[model samples]
Target: MTAGFEAIEYSSRDGIAVVRLNRPAQRNALDLTMRGEIGRAVEAIRDDASIRVLLLIGSGGSFCAGGDLKALTERERGALANRDRIRRLHLWFSELLNLEKPVVAAVDGPAFGAGLNLALAADFVLASPRARFCAVFARIGLVPDLGGFFLLPRIVGLQKARELIFTARVVGAEEAQRLGIVTEIHSEETLEPAAMAWCRRLLEAPTGTIGMAKNILNQSFNLDQRALAELEAYAQAVAMETADHRTRVGDFLAKKPLRYDWEALGRAEDGQ
Candidate 1:
């Protein structure tokens, strides 16, 4: 476990890593230290091949409430500190966006501002039935940062994104799902478990294939239809070349159900 997380808590289970923002008092409002640690952890995921999935969660009822406003107001720093804070936020997010493995967010409560965007960064999100998301930046006379502008519009369309950011409106989990923000909603008690379950299923999938798909999906943002079609063909060709895919295809061609050995995974990726 990392230290001083009075702001966050982290633990590992099976092959899944859980990162919990633990500061209920201030809603896990991020500061410099928390951001640095989280950025480190996120980037570290790539090197830990034993782990195939990651769960980003929170303690108390708040995932995170953006940067701790109270902490900011109390700080006595030159403009440099403010710039550094914003830069740190971007660094953490870049770490998130660059992660190679599947990431699942199990959101149990409110995720606002940077918090909501963090949830959005995951490959998919599962929220508690009562969970709420908001773009509260405008509400407090702040502009959205931390990739919100780049990600939100693509998830919900330009018009809906504008309303969300401009009005600072809150959306429930169901509406979030409708807007393609969340993939499912679980009972509060099962939110984290369900997210992990989903992550485990993802781990069983072909690792190289998922990584390639993610790369292609990220590039879909800038590609034309023809280019997208070409990429799809290329992706399918590459996915068919993986060891997992070859094994499964052999089973399929032989009309047998493919089986995997759990013990084999630890030996698969660079012998982690």
Candidate 2:
């Protein structure tokens, strides 16, 4: 299914939902229309169980340059209105954070300001070697919005996060990988195929179990040990009740070939 959106393109094939940021001429800048389209597209993805994975990418060479500066400057709004606008963005950003299925960001070229935060929301970020990232909000005299404040510190350490934000430092894909920002770096030509292959590999596993675990892990830093233990118990109970769990267990007991043997799969893929 392909949804012809104005600022964004949404399509699904082979259980993968690809959300492409359009408007390459503007470097896929996030304008009001783009924001609204993204929210609607994500809502559609949330309601569709057939879409097992979400891949966010940019249409042109640049991923996203940032907000539409001209639009932002021309728009006149009071403090309350601006506050409301930010809150609306938070709602959709939170939706991405709480999404059950895996979200992969295939970032090529530059992902600056809010764009970087958008990529940070993904479960995995596969960046091209030419990918450039920056918290460019500082240069524009704006603090990081779009949940960048919340997401950055957790991925990179507090000190590193501060340096990136304070300095508005730009890092290439290799350095981003060193800082745990980019999960993997591929050549620009190979990035799309690599990301799709990774998604297919993920499709081999029990998605329900993985989604639940991701939910729990996302809250790990915020929850105390006791609270975490309680959540662990609840999550495990819910997982154990699933037929996928039971079937996998039965297969193990019967010495049958397992479907989600990640290590075995890795070895096979490596021709080991």
Candidate 3:
């Protein structure tokens, strides 16, 4: 299925929803219209039970070039107005960040500023060899937005995050992988396929179990051990009651193949 939007393309098939930034001419830059469309797309994904994974990518060989500077400079807005605009972004961004379903970002070219943060929001970032990432806010005399303040520091250490933000230096795909930014790098030709493969593997798991675990894990940094233990106990109790969990246990006792096995999936992908 597909939903038509001006600045973005939303499509879903076989449990995977693909949200592609469509403003290729501007290097898929984030404009007001694009932002609105993205929010709408995210809402669709959230409301649809059939959609198990989200694959965020960009058209025209570029992931995203961050905000459309031309659009931002076209008007002079008050500090209050700018603040409101950013707050609006958090409305949808927060949902995407805490989304129960897995999100995979397939980045090919530049993912700068807010673009970089968008990829960071994903559960896994699969980049192409030519992909580039940057905390470009400093270069423009601005601070990072789109959850960069929360996400970047968690992915890279606080010291590394500060250095990257201060320098605003572009990070190549290899360096990004080393810094724990990119989950894996594939060749340009295989980036999308690899991302889809990842989605397929995730689809094999029990969605409710994964979603519950993800909900708890997102708060692991903020919650104390006691709080986390309580959450874990609750989640595990819910998971144990699920029919999927019972079926898996039955399969194990019957000496049947498990429903979800990551290594088995890898071997199947390798044609083993």
User: Each model's TM-score, in the order given?
Assistant: 0.86, 0.95, 0.97
lDDT of 1 at 32: 63
- Candidate 1 lDDT at 150 equals 83
Point out the higher-scoring one by lDDT: 1 or 3: 3
Error of model 3, residue 5, in angstroms: 0.5
Cα displacement (angstroms), candidate 3, residue 189, comes to 0.6
**Pairs with steric clashes in candidate 2:** none
Per-residue lDDT of candidate 3, residues 189-214 (tens digit): 98998898999988888888888888
**Best of the two (1, 3) by TM-score:** 3
| Residue runs of model 1 more than 4 Å from their true location after superposition | 1-6, 76-81, 226-238, 258-272
Q: Provide the clashing-pair count of each candidate structure.
A: 0, 0, 0
lDDT of 1 by residue, 1-272 (tens): 65444456766667777788777777777776677778777766767777778889888876777777877788588879777878768866876775767888888778899888888888889999888999989998998877899889989999999999999999999999999999989898888767766766666866667777887787788899999999999989978777889888898899875444444543443245
Name the lDDT value of residue 218 in candidate 1.
75
| Leading candidate by lDDT | 3
lDDT of each: 0.80, 0.89, 0.93
Model 2 global lDDT (CA atoms, 0 to 1): 0.89
Q: Which ten residues in a row have the lowest lDDT in candidate 3?
A: 1-10
